[model samples]
Target: MKALISTGGQGPDFEKVKDIFTHVNLVVAADSGLNRLVEWGIEPDFLVGDGDSIDTENVATKKYSYNPAPRDKDFSDTELAIIKCLEKGADEIILIGGGEGRLDHTLSNVGMVKKYAQISLWMTSKEIITILSPGNFITHHLPQTQLSIFPLDDHSGPVKTRGLVWELEHIDLNQSMSLSNRCVDSEINWEITQGRFLLLATYE
Candidate 1:
């Protein structure tokens, strides 16, 4: 199943979330994320959080099911939402509102994608970010969108790409290298020979 997870950080544009809402099998909210959905006049299938950042009365009016967690816990509210999605057999998860907030929280949320590497996961704000495991991956984006690739660990070996302004042919990537490149074509094809990396695409 495909899951859409809204987190309690800086939310993405309403249009962006709405565009994919119809494609998801499930929608979940984490804490203040409920507030975001309420503002958008949309209700999620399930809500997961500690009930700390949301108005209890407002939530009571919503008919959606909720899973309250302890205020003090090992995981963040977003993580809890992810766990719920996974428990419900979600093979793919799209995380919204996970970026552009508390630096630590944003980092933690990004780390979650790495932890759940077995599943296809994405985090989006002004930019869409995903971890690319070793294999061929294809993506489509508008022309002129900025595309960047970075090694998640010490180094990634022999990365190859096409459809970008600066195409790569089996080139090594490391933390120090930031390919602030752009897509000349709508279709992007990439392959990683070894190791994993983060792929980011955003409007310039």
Candidate 2:
């Protein structure tokens, strides 16, 4: 199953986010992230978080599975939300979050995607971050978007890319450092034979 988790950060333009709704089987709101959904008039299937960032008085009134954790818990609201998604048998997760707010949260959210292969994509307010795990991915998002593809982990080697100005091929070393590459075609493809890497596509 595919799950969509929303975090309390800057939100993407609703018009640009319409396509993702058609692909998700589950929708989740992480703590105050519900506020963003409320703004968009989108209700989530599950609301998981510490219930501290938003108005707690109205939480119970919402018709959804509200799993509230202690505010002093070890996990973050976003992490808790992902755990909830995994418990529901979600094989793929698309995290909807913004790049604004706490910087640690932003980095940690991106780290979760890099650490866990189940997270295929993270659609932020500013960019579309794709985590590739040694396979092929084709995205038809934002033609000519400022794209930067690189291997976050050095072990990620032997990667191939198509439809980018600077395609990764016939390169030496264990990791790649290709940046400032734009989508040559409306549909862009990326493939890696081994290890993992991440691709950042700006919403420009």
Candidate 3:
């Protein structure tokens, strides 16, 4: 089943998000993300975090509360939520509000998304972010929207992107480069040979 995790991030269309994610089988709140559920009058099935940023008692029950350590340096709240979902046999993950007002948190959340690379992870806000390995990827976009594929690590060889405005062929994309790519078509597809890449599909 698919899992939905809410994070305390800056999302302008928060009110409109619930409708987009109503198909999710289970809902989870990460730390202060519980406030987002409260704003919508919807209680999450589980709450995962350090329990410092949020009060566990405010939720429907403390039974599903997963309190880690305030000093634990292994995982972030978002990463913990992903592990919980994975343990419960989740095949896909959808994250909302992961790009909140804080730049550090937003960047950390993106890193967390990459850590859950074993599963099909998708982050949604005003835009959608996804990661793909060496495989055929397909996604739809609106007119003038941008789509960029950048290698997360140093490229071992070459990569190719098709159906985009500024297509790349066997290009070396490392962490030092590749960000804010613009989309040029209503549909996009790509193929890769070296390293895993992050796909940022935006509607701007």
Instruction: Return the TM-score for each candidate structure.
Output: 0.87, 0.86, 0.80
Across residues 1-204, which tens digit of lDDT does each residue of candidate 1 receive?
899888887766787668788899988898888888888888899999999998776688889887689999998998889899999999888888876768898789767776776335455566777678888988888888897887765557777888988887744475344577888998989877887777787744
**Pairs in clash, predicted candidate 2:** none
Query: Which residue pairs show backbone clashes in model 3?
Result: 9-100, 10-100, 146-182, 146-183, 147-183
The worst-scoring run of ten residues by lDDT in candidate 1 lies at 170-179
Tens digit per residue, CA lDDT, model 2, 83-196: 899999999998887577888887788678766678988888888887767777777766788887666565777877788777777764264466777887888776788876
lDDT of each: 0.79, 0.80, 0.69
Pairs with backbone N, CA or C atoms under 3 Å apart (clashes), candidate 1: none
Query: Candidate 1, after superposition: displacement of residue 144 in Å?
Result: 1.7
Index of the highest-TM-score prediction: 1
Q: Can you rank all candidates by lDDT, best first?
A: 2, 1, 3
Clashes per model (N, Cα, C within 3 A): 0, 0, 5
Q: List residue ranges in candidate 2 displaced over 4 A.
A: 56-60, 136-138, 170-176
Per residue, candidate 3 scores C-alpha lDDT tens digits across 67-129 of 554757588888888888888888888777765377888778767766676445455555666
Rank list by TM-score? 1, 2, 3
Model 1 CA lDDT for position 45: 90
